[model samples]
Target: MEHDYYKEYYELERNHWWFVAREGILSNYIHRLIEQGKLSSKDLKILNVGCGPGRSSEYLSKFGKVTSIEYDEFCCEFASKKTGLEIINGSITELPFEDNSFDLVCAFDVVEHVEDDQLAVKELKRVTKKGAFVLITVPAFMDLWSHHDVINHHFKRYKIKEVNLLFDTINDGNKVFDTYFNSLLFLPIYFFRKVSNFLKLGQKRKGSGSDFEAFKPGVLNRILYKIMYFESSVINRKIRFPFGVSILYNWKKF
Candidate 1:
């Protein structure tokens, strides 16, 4: 990301509806794992791969100990200050951890940035304990690609078929359990981005979101959150949506 956009992200993450809704989705998954005895918050050792400013890492801390890795020094510094957790300056393409180092590994919106996503997935599996879960989230659909992707240095957006194919190649023997989310508002967002792309409207025409400002009522924010939260509730019940703005997966290492 451009230098200023990182600042924008840091400032907005705490209050943005998008960020809050994303956390709500992940939080539901974590809590369910606890309920099913698949994960124990107190004993888990977690690796937060490519955590942007460690926001997700900080959230994961409530579930277990979290160690973060990011390739950028700026992100490492910001995340360190925000979470005060150990932040390693590293890349997902080659995580600097020994085999089976963590009980849980999370790579959210991170793989798309890597040049070799397959290798990155392999590293995620390599670092995780056998039968441990790795949660991944990435932007969905190549058709949705625009300057937002270019500005963020994303290599590829994903489709459900291709994403599962990557996992199967390096399966290590576990099945892929996954879903598409950010569903209800996908059409509006898609059209908005399309128009924005056609007009090339962005922060200083840089194809970034930093200069974009949003003002909404507290009620509005809450309503949006609730709508998304309801979709997450559907996800929690183990039903996967057929299409959405993003894709999420939970693959257990074997």
Candidate 2:
């Protein structure tokens, strides 16, 4: 199946709660990276692979120029209109830019859908400047397979060590700086979904399906968002979890 189908699948889910939760987590991570001086406005030129709706690119643009590439044409149009950034319609394996052109490259929630994730990582490394970073996030735990995986066209969720190994194989001179999971509070939600599937409580789930609603702001919603923000601060620092809804990795070329 062409992975572009996965893009269309998620385009329908842009406003769901799952999407909101994802954005919140990404915002928190970027804020930390910016604060830590890992990124700066003085540095220009960034490449955002699988830059759905350009949400992260919008934030990244503040630091410099951002060029986002996405496989889904609909997503590219939506993101171009929404973020007003330079976005190209293309896949990660066939990036439109020249080599060693970007200061930072990001592929958020994108790798799992690729048929050969390691080859895609190699492409990411090829385009990034030496000493620059490639940031990525993907679903974790293959056993947590549910409707979301089927709908999203995820080949499989990742194990940190497995992903590390893949990155190592394709990294060339790059080294993984850190790796951790996100959405700790929502781990239970994933657990429930997985257990429900295992027990056959519902029909077999398929695709990148999520029940999360994004703009349904309420007191509980606000609280949950705050909790996630707090978690981002303490996670991978004070707390180390073996599993969660998503995994984040930051890799740097040496």
**Candidate closest to the true structure, highest lDDT:** 1
Clashes of 2: 17
lDDT of candidate 1 over 46-157, digit per residue (tens): 9999888667888888888888888888878876887677889988978899999888899999999988898988899889998788889999998888777777888999
- Model 1 CA lDDT for position 225: 70
* Steric clash pairs (candidate 1): none
How much does candidate 1 score in TM-score? 0.92
Worst 10 residues of 2 by lDDT: 205-214
| Tens-digit lDDT track of model 2 for 64-180 | 778878898876776677557778899888787788888888898888989988888888888988777788888887767876566556788988887788778843565544455
| Model 2 stretches astray by more than 4 angstroms | 1-21, 34-36, 174-176, 195-209, 213-216, 235-240
RMSD of 2: 3.9
Give all candidates' CA lDDT scores.
Answer: 0.81, 0.69
